[model samples]
Target: MKIELIYPRWKKLEGQTTFHLPPHGPVVMAAALPPGVELDFLDENVDPRDALAACEGCDLVCISMMLTSQVKRGWALADQLRARGLRVLFGGIASMLHAEETLAHADALFLGEVEGRLGAVLEDLAHGRLQKVYNFMQAHPPIELVGPARRSILRDELYHHKGVRMVDLFHASRGCRFKCYPCAVAYLGGRSFRPRPMARVAEELAAIPNGRLFVVDNSLAQDKEWEKELFRTMIPFKKTWCSHTIEDDDEVLALAAQAGAWYVYQAVFDTSDFIRQRVKRYHDHGIAVEGTVLLGLDDQTEDSIRRLIDFLLEIDLDLAEFTVLTPFPHTKCRDDLRKQKRILSDDWDRYTAGEVVFQPKHMSPARLQELYHLAWETFYRDEPQSMKMMKLLQRAVARERALGTYRGRRRDLVRQSFGRELTDEERGV
Candidate 1:
């Protein structure tokens, strides 16, 4: 049987530098499919065409969504495909979060991880017995069942930034132990942290052809011993990577740096000394820091938001991404906002963290929106976002060179060169 897996695209945060990192959910799901199925994958962010063209004589089409903003587009695509007499299924994070609504637009809706589960779904499809919903939200498969992502289905050439090949997304673990106020990870992946076997992780890392990767684990700070062992297993690969926060310990940091840690997406929520020291420790370990700062939190006033931006600069973050607090479905932030009647809109499209859809505790919605832009502008005033990103790329390249894993730049493709000013057309003029 043949299946088409399509990842629907969503609008990126306007305040950040625009680029597409390959999606991980679809590829990982692809690996879980039973053997001998011909798979056609399309990441609509880079491959703009809808799945109709790829679904020729296909048995099933899976619409995988990872963000709230993608739900509308995913529903539209599913509606369009089903109209043409093709069977369409909805899965992934966004689909789980919005399952009740997504089922209206899908032939089947799958929730929870796909490992060791797709065979049954496909068997039902083959026998014309497809169910309306396969709810596995709480029935997570054993972590050992997770396998290497099926990247063979990806069109690798389409994923790049300027002339540099973007990092391939990989995950050594699943689930997050911490449930932040604005995050739905606990609701989606459970509060227990489930890590893949180290052997499996090593095998996946070795099989990945890319020299750089973005380890897309929800957070690596959960199990200290596991984090250390994962880094130790990765040391020989010499592949530079960026990931979410690692365990904030001297030994863990040392292991990570030895494992070719390039940079990390460290959250900077406040101007406290503890946060300052956390950023410093990452930098001290020779890992570049990219501060992921969320603005317009309940405690944040205009002055506090501005202070946070200044603190980011003071800490010498290699790059900073500023986003407004978005209350996505199933997150505590959304529950609180809705209860207080502070949520201004139910429009999921505008829920892109760049836009303010709810009233702030200390300021008006308009004021919070203005501060969002101000945070981005103030952070990148001296150094353009692109320039800061290019430096991170350079550091990755240097690490590769030192480890004898560097491949000379590929000059055949045409895109804006890093460190060069973006053209008017490239800048959306």
Candidate 2:
């Protein structure tokens, strides 16, 4: 029997970055399917046409989705596949928490981690005993049970969009240890870090093309020693990479820089002495750090927002992304917002981090929305600072493209270059 795994596109939001890469959830789910099962993976974000066309012959279709903005698109895809007379199964962070709503459109719903329950689900389907719901209670499954994702299905041509050559896509671990109130990782993976073996991770990285790699892990610093070791191994490859980091550890930061990490996506939730120290480490390492700020946290007052902006400017971060805090389903913040009657919008489509979902403690919902727009306008709107960022990014793009050509890498010369500073004028920052 043939099985198709589909990932839906997110709703378009102004000023927000649209990810044209494959979704990791469906890739991991494809990895876990029973051996010999005729499985195909489709990420509509990158391969929409092939995905829609592949829906024809599949015996069963599974959709992995998020709760925020992808709800409508996900359901629409499910509805389409069902119209083709294929049994539809839905799962992911969003579907896990909102099973009843998802079940309205899908024939079966799997909750929690897909790796643990995938085999049984496939067997049940083969024997004509499919159930409406399957839940995996364990938070972390054994590594042996987690099979390698079938990423080979992704073609080299898919990476060559507009000009960006795609490189390796990897997940070093599962679960986040932080209890950040608004983050879904804390709720879904629990407050514990479960990492894959460093040796296996290194092997995987070595197997991928020797270019810029993107680590989709929650945060590289979650396991300091493991991250350090990984960086040490990566240094030899001299391949630029990007990953999320909470704060800068002096040793790790240095190692990451030497290992060819061009950019670090750091989360600056609040400004403090600790944050200052971390930012200094990035500056000292000559690494371009992109500071991502959450503007609509409960504690963010008008003064605090202005202060945060000033801090970001003071640090001269290469790039920054300011988003309103969203309380996704299954997160503590969502529950709290529901109880406090702070959620101003029930429309799941607007739940993407770009939208203001709840009224802030210090500001009304409308004021919060205005503040969100103001933050972007103040930072990225044809200002000198924004212009500087754009020039930096343009230079970096040219440099990376040159390097790609010299190296004779078949990868498209997309903006995969690191250290290019983007200005507000160029990016409309």
Candidate 3:
């Protein structure tokens, strides 16, 4: 049997550059496929022109319905592949959001983690007993059984630009313990944090050839012991990686830096001085900090949004990603908005973090959206073009050098990664 797995590009606004990181989902799921299957993987965001090519000569074509930004394209791609007489499968976050519509497109829908389910699906396919929908949410697949992602199957060239690969993605843990309103993780991966055993995590890290990684855990702050041990275990690997962490403790932060933490995705939800202090601490420890601003929060006004941007500049954040407070399906935020009649649209495309889809508590939704756009514009606008490009180049060079991963094609990939060629983020980051 043959299988083709795909992770599609996320559609974003014009002028913004995207660098496709190594996708964690499709690679991880590919690891679950039983042996002797001819496996192929495609990252549509990089070379979208030939995304459909991966389906050729495959027994089963699987495309991830991963995010709101990708669903529209994901559906169309799945339908097109199905027309080619291939059996199509849909899975991931978006599948949970648009299950009914998704089911109509694919031959089967594999819901939630495939740990305990893929074997059955492959077994059934062999015996001709496959089902239309396989929901493994109830199984709560044991974290111990989570296998190392089959990273070797990826087309490395597709991930590199100008010479450096942006980042390799992996998760030391699954699910989020907190039920934040705008989050879809709790419903999808359950509210509890399920971490892979430290030994398994170590083994996986050793196997991944890339030194630069993007740890996809929602937050490492939830478990101090696990976070500390994770970094400790990673020290031997000598890998420099980044991930989201609200870990405020000085000791924990120090340990992470010692383990080669390049940076962390720190959420700046308010204008509190604590935010300033925390960012400074991260800098003090030789770790860069990228701020994630959630713009459509009830407390934010036009002035507040601008003020946050100013604060980000003042703190000299490494980078900032500004997004509207999206109320996604099965999230507490969506339920609350539905009750208050604040949801403006259920149209999945608009659910991209850049667009506002819900009514705000203070300002008009349009105003919130304006601020969101302004934040991105103001962010890059305030920085000189040369400085922006220089910073981008420096970051790329440092990561590539640190990992010593890519060779020969470095200069061109680095230049392209910086948008020297005017490529809109075809896919990634």
Name the best candidate (by lDDT): 1
- Give model 3's TM-score versus the native structure: 0.90
User: Residue by residue across 205-241, what tens digits does model 3's lDDT show?
Assistant: 9898777788889898989888899889988877778
Model 2, position 332, has a per-residue lDDT of 85
Per-model TM values vs. the true structure: 0.96, 0.86, 0.90
lDDT of 1 by residue, 327-399 (tens): 8999999999999999998888888988999989999999998988887888889989988887888888788
User: Runs in model 3 with CA error above 4 Å?
Assistant: 384-429
Local lDDT at 46 for model 2: 59
Write down the lDDT of every candidate, Cα atoms only.
0.88, 0.72, 0.79
> In model 1, which runs have C-alpha deviations exceeding 4 angstroms?
416-429
Clash count for each candidate, listed in order shown = 0, 17, 10
Error of 2 at 286 (Å): 2.4
* Candidate 2 per-residue lDDT over residues 28-147, each given as its tens digit: 777677677887776666563666688788788888886557777888888877787788999888886666788888889987787667878888887999998886644567754555
RMSD values, in order shown? 2.5, 4.8, 3.6
What is residue 269's positional error in candidate 1, in angstroms? 1.3
Worst 10 residues of 1 by lDDT: 413-422
Name the lDDT of candidate 2.
Answer: 0.72
